[model samples]
Target: MSSNSNSNSGRRRPALLVLDLINEIVHPDGKYAADGYFAQARDRSVLERTAEAIARARAADIPVIYVVVGFSADYTEWPAGSPVFEKARADGRLKLGTWATQVHDALAPEPGEPVVAKHRISPFHGTNLELLLRTREIDTLLLTGVSTELVVLTTAQAGHDLDFRVQVLEDATLAGDAEIHAAALKVLSRIATVTTVEGALPSTG
Candidate 1:
């Protein structure tokens, strides 16, 4: 966890970033469930915790941004030689217009919440996420998502570089296994505040 006193200070303008909670990655019936993300997510109660985080953000009047990874029907934006996304291309998963790319129902975005689509691990890459944050004056980020080693970590590093204070809600995220999740959180602790939803956003009195 980051020791900086201001890491979770209440005064900082914050936005909740829900990353890759789409069906293809975390849903039980999704194509990528065979990779163990679904099991880990279920075992860790990631969806439940993430729901709580989202609700808290909403109650606190914080902007909530959803980032989903998907490709067009023809996949013109798909990265051709990348190891991470190769399986997705091969399996024809993560199609933008399909159920596979939709956000999980448990944590669905409300009527007007922005759902930004990206073709890469980092939400900031080739997406208007940064512009949204800048326009909203969001200087802090509360991250909650699936596959801790991938999107969560990538976004934390990129957000830090972009000078936004980043906090990863540990209980609201997981990897393919406990060890991988822990290791990723350990690495993220140095650059971002690794905290639980409660720790980052206490309930109102």
Candidate 2:
């Protein structure tokens, strides 16, 4: 079905799901910089593109929702033996209330925009994301954020399985490596409509 299509009926209630584009992962001095993911995000100008996407979505009256990843100060929510989050807990990154956990300044959420904090890569895991979407009646999601191979890929598939119309904004997401980004996009195209920021927006002309 088209991104604007709803599961129960042919109605469109679209929203933008901005995932994990926080300082803890996207900035040059982020705690995960040593992992080399931030470098790729910067090179790809993910923040700039995401900023543009937010602007376009807002202009089109689309709900803009941010999904941020952070942990309790005591690291209580850090899942045990999880490869994706083990290093973060060990290195003390993504501490709540820290500057590193804030969304990238370029794409800071405006007033009234919902910011969903999640502990896992998938925004829906252990979070109220589904509830929020259901409340807003949003069934079509425009997914954007860092590490296309992980969060973006996972969320796209999950969103599809959940009966939501999903679309991945190519220019607005970043990955650890160019090859990985390309491969994820290729795979995601099968489950979701992969488009650039401009293409994802409704035509003003």
Candidate 3:
């Protein structure tokens, strides 16, 4: 279906989902960073692009939501010895008061935008992201963030399953696995609209 067709079919309000673009945490740099085909040096440009997208979304008056990873005082939610997280814990990473847990200041949401704490790949998985979006009467979600194949793709899949009108800003999302990112784009295009950051703009009134 066309983008408008999918959106207008049932969507009520527009919102933005900004995944974990916080700090330098990513699949390409931690315990999972060098695993198999995911191995690649983190791309600085991708992070900058995501920052740019966030700025644009805010300018458009689209409600923005941010997701970040942080652990409780005792790290209860983190599975003991899980390779993806254990290494970080051992290295003293993403602790509640640490720098890695903070959203990069350049792209931080404003006073009223919601911030969801996450423990896994999908921010919507263990967080109240869905409830916040619903409370805002938002039916359309524009996804923007780092590592497209991981957080972006996972959250997008979850959003699709939840029956939200999904639109991924192609330039706004990135990934360590080029193939995985490409595959995600193709599959998501089948289910949601894909547009460039420049293509989506603040509506002049």
Best by lDDT: 1
Better of 1 and 2 by TM-score: 1
Give lDDT tens digits, candidate 2, residues 80-186. Answer: 88988888777788987899889988899999999999998889998999889888888888989988999999999889988888999999988888998999999
The C-alpha lDDT values of all candidates are 0.91, 0.87, 0.69
Off by over 4 Å in 1: 1-10
Going through the candidates in order, what is the number of backbone clashes in each?
0, 0, 1
lDDT of 1 by residue, 1-205 (tens): 1324345555688999999998998998999898999999888899999999999999989999999999999999999988889987787989998999999999999999999999998999999999999888788899999779999999999999888899999999889889999999999999999999999889995
Candidate 1 residue 100 C-alpha distance from true site, Å: 0.3
User: Candidate 2, overall lDDT?
Assistant: 0.87
Residues 1-205 of candidate 3 have per-residue lDDT tens digits of 3345556667446787777766645444433345432232244355456666667667777788888877876677777867556766666666666666667666766888788888877888777888887777777788877566777777778888887777888766766666766887887787778886666544343
Greater lDDT among 1 and 3 belongs to: 1
Model 2 per-residue lDDT at 11:
64
Q: Evaluate model 1: give its TM-score.
A: 0.94
Q: In terms of TM-score, which candidate is stronger, 1 or 3? A: 1
